[model samples]
Target chain A: MTISTMRLTGVAAACAIFSINAFAEDSSLTNPAISAVLDGYYQSAERPMSERVEGFGLGHTEVAMSANIDDMFYGKLTAVIEMHDGETELGLEEAFIQTLAMPYGLSMRAGRFLSDIGYLNNQHVHTDAFSDRPAAYRAFLGSHYFDDGVRLSYVAPTDLYWTMGVEAFKGDNMRAADEHNERDYKSTGVYTAFTKIGGDAGINGSWQAGLSYLRNENGRMTAEEHDHVAVLDEHDHEHSHSAQYTGENTYVADFVYKWAPNGNYKYQHLTLSGEFFRVTDFKPLEEEHDEHDAHDDEGKDYQDGWYLSSVYQFSPHWSAGLRYGQVDTQMMHDDHFDPQKLKETEVSLAWHQSHFSTVRLQYTNQQGTNFDGIEDDNVITLQYIMTLGAHGAHQF
Target chain B: MRINSKQFLPKALKTLTLAVTLGFISNAQAEFNIFACEPEYAALAKELAPDARIYSATTAMQDPHQVQARPSLIAKMRQADLAICAGADLEIGWLPMLQMKSANAKVRSTDQGLFFAAEQIDTVDQMKSVDRSMGDVHAKGNPHLHFDPKRLLGVAEALTQKLMQLDPDSTAQYQANLARFSQRWNDAIPRWEQKAKPLNGKKIIAYHSSFKYLFNWLGLEQVADLEPKPGIPPSSSHLASLLTRAKQGDILAIIIASYQSERGADWLGERADLPVIVLPMSVGGNEQSVDLFSLYDSAIDLLLAAK
Candidate 1:
């Protein structure tokens, strides 16, 4: 057998062994459901050689264990093994316990988990239709937002589906966490609230819309010292610079629509979804100048982004999708520091071999401004995802 | 402390009025709500509790093995007074998550309000040892027990008892409904058997093991399966082999459920010069299959027509 096939066979055997052991050890008790997903990809990007991430890579091998702790509680743990910077790394993706029966129609979850901030933030990468995350998500939320926190949600007793939820987190996200300044870290750093409503539009269509708000109270970042010299008559003077930031607030709105003829998804279906995000109140940086000369570091920082995508399943095995994403960022007050705006367009075609496996080919074209200047890149990726054991169905 | 008869009388009268208003409001909102995982259980629940609001998570056109977690399903499950399902892990993919997310105490697995129709009947084709190679087989045996009329009657009785337990005031009405339904169903059984006599001993091919109960009930022999194993799609080699078998033996027809893909059955039927029959696997699969009795009637009609 080829090397890749042999490796896949080994991985499959290991997964089977793990599942059997888990089941045998807890045969008397309720055996936890064991599932594993393997994702691998071949990607090539047309960019500067130093800035390109092109090659065959293992995306992430995710293993999940879930079961009912008792009649009143349910628990799930997911761990992922991935390749990072040419080294293999293992990390805990999600570990949470959620209430099965709570008073007053309240359900609560606690522990480390992905934040339900936007439409696709909580979903794993393998579940995504595209090979990579949207540029808007990557720029705005650093791919995804996960933190140690607690969430409480209420499902309204109404004819239509209406739910409201709130969460409190440690605020260890891209723009929130400050690893250098430990003493200034707030205990309840980030708080969020969201409301979602969904209903059947007709016999073949359904839609869901949600509004969310997130606030980070205190965040810190260490800005490196930079020195500038004026070269008018060959005279040079050095000035020290450092900065700190406090926090930020964000708002997001998302909507999703799906249609399946006669309520049968096996033949033909269509899904359309979009999410818009706006970030503001990025507290002004406090600049520290070492020289006696006064330096003004006043700047307005703001970011906004949105993504829209549509996936059409024409047959039981074939599907195609297209996505458009754009992000804008303003970090400095200087007019010469052009505000960065990045736009990306991607298209994908996939073949679902069965319920447990999929092979996809995707192409992305990205063009816009970066910190350095105008930038453009083209990326092509071929990915394969396989699931073994009892993987749960995805939520709409 | 001495004697305030006028004030006491007015206060007592006001309290009585408030209590009566609240009681009326609670009574007005007491209508039972049931959430069924499949159309068959929903049809059965409708028979037992005609006044209760019913919601079925999946239609007959959809696969019962897996389902998307729709928001409406969670909402209905949360408000359900009773949750009924064909639960031999038939809904293992989505039901557990729905139940956990709903956080509704009334219909938890351990509660009296939860009813599993499979638990009321004996299952067949149960494997002694289950492995993935068996192709997604249910560990507790086959869960499609609704095809057999006798087993369905037993499930109805059990479900009626549960309805009585949840709503004690409706005990008399539920019992009466059960009696009437049982009598009507028993009378129809012999008539169906007489009509389906021509189908007896006929060898057929099936897309999946979904028709096991129906075959067992009608004494029809399932000679071969288009799919190599349960839940696995038919491969070219498997279909070719079945076609060769068809030439050697007398195969009556190729049968598939409404929810299954018809490509394999059509492919095999064309080459073997046999008819491909699509049967309503559950209620509401077609316009004619509106309820439990009609679901079977429609299925048998399709099967007999193929013959």
Candidate 2:
């Protein structure tokens, strides 16, 4: 067995050298740059959430390849691999082609991609300072809103940085769950427009602020638990019924400010960012048997949320952050159902071993009031993120 | 429809006026714009073109290997007529992203407007084979060729040709500028050689391979590296081993670039009873190193002071 193992190892070494020589000769100029990110976590939570797992689990592991297809176009493809309920699942995260050279500072992108609606939505999960996204993002955007889309953006030729963009998407991926199976949409279902402006405060500081609007042609179905009360049947058994709401429009405003002494991120830095989101143009869709129909006539149905976070790297390897997020929902204007609210606070400490690797420990507390009554839970998670191969540079 | 027409008319007039004003400004100042990745190249372009507007993406106080692809830099690249950089994977981290993001044809690698300075000169330490375990080695060779005065002259000639090709109307001017600059550079080389004669064959420790070209030019030897590996910072274990090596009486002082952290070098210097010399690695690295000529002068002066 030992002799065979040595022979195998010898063969492997020879092949490796041969491949390296081949790669050096001409492969790099023709082959796409390949990269992969591995994320894993161990968490202990009093109550399980959509993203928080109880024990050891994979988190957002992905492999990506990108290259300029020609003089005019660049392409990238990213695939995600994860375990869901003891089953391995493979999915395409993004596959997009972007224009390399367009006239008048205009660029276009087409394919399945993350929407450029908010500051953190377009960035991958591994790039996040904290282990989990803010509560508002989870509730409103399902953590991130990615779908098949085409986008056209224009960068202004000005001293101060400014860009404007518009996008249209199939929107099947971004739609909310329909519990009653009452809604359907075909063709292009989502459209978005956004504008961002940024400038450097000095050599040590820079900031960007943006406002975005999303219009969903097909509205979403949501439960209105505030107004409906439980009714007792003839057998003296309690039955619960709630009104339904359909929401359409969303607006997001985000801002970020970063400061690094002498513009060097290697040693120390601070990042402060916040986002506000609102869902409007919502109305009552169904009320079971018309008993709660009075709530349908009421207007001004809306939902809004906001989050603020700050991460400070005091040393080269260590960083700590705190985030607070709150989301409120008023599906109906009537007082029969109280407004539902969810709030979460999180604190995390990360050890960045290098630019490509990080280990983080996070603590989270969630408190909220809904039809399920007041909820309070605490969670602790230990996570690691590592990247390998030719990774692309991160954007500011 | 009437209200829309009124809004459109005003917007159209404002855009037309802005366009006309911008056109006038650009035409009045028709000098070529160059974006250099490092300060040394920026200074060189200024010497060669004299009239061209130039922007340096990084200063001496910053590391060129890893730079934030900031939006302002993208804006600068979008307006650039030519982009020049030390391109033997030295800018592998950020420059490609800048090229793609700027969506500028002139700055793309495949275009004639983007120039790689390292390609113009045969560099030292060209590796036949490499790996990441070897600590960020470039297969093409060392990209810090600007430190070698002889190679830099060759680069100046190539850049003069490139400038002429891009701006044909100024061919005669560029030729004159190169002749004058080369003459002055040729005269200064021997003076620098005389000043640095005593420093030949000296051995010193450094943070990274950033000074290999400079050492090669000056005939100095690198004794040990402060970093445990290429691109990695010096750890306690590595420093402890270096402490024993520093006691061997022949080793000179520890040298580091201006942008490097002083902690590791200072610790070694304190324990080993050696001087920690901070050399200005590029143009504008120090007040005295305002340009290329003074940059070398300042570096040699600091090394001599340490000796």
Error of 1 at A303 (Å): 0.9
Off by over 4 Å in 2: A1-30, A46-52, A180-182, A222-246, A285-300, A330-338, A371-374, B1-30, B128-130
Per-residue C-alpha lDDT of model 1 across residues A1-396, encoded as one tens digit per residue:
111111224455457557655774565744688788888888885321111246887776788888888887888887766554444445566889988778656889999787877778877777888877776666555466667799999887665888888999876443332323444656677888988888777667878889988887753233323322111111011000001122367889999998887666766788999999887665334432323223332244456789999999887678999999887764433221125677889899999866677899998887877432337777798889888877566577
Scanning candidate 1 chain B in windows of ten residues, the lowest lDDT window is B125-134
Residues A164-260 of candidate 2: C-alpha lDDT, one tens digit per residue: 8999987764454343456566569789999888877888888889999998776554554544432101111100011122248889999999888
Calculate DockQ per candidate and list them: 0.45, 0.50
- Residue range B166-272, candidate 2, lDDT tens digits: 89999999999999999989999999889998889998989888889888888899999998877677788999898899999777789998878899999999999
DockQ (0 to 1) for model 1: 0.45
Best of the candidates, DockQ: 2
DockQ-based CAPRI category assigned to the predicted complex of candidate 2: medium
Of candidate 2 chain A, the 10-residue stretch with the lowest lDDT total is A232-241
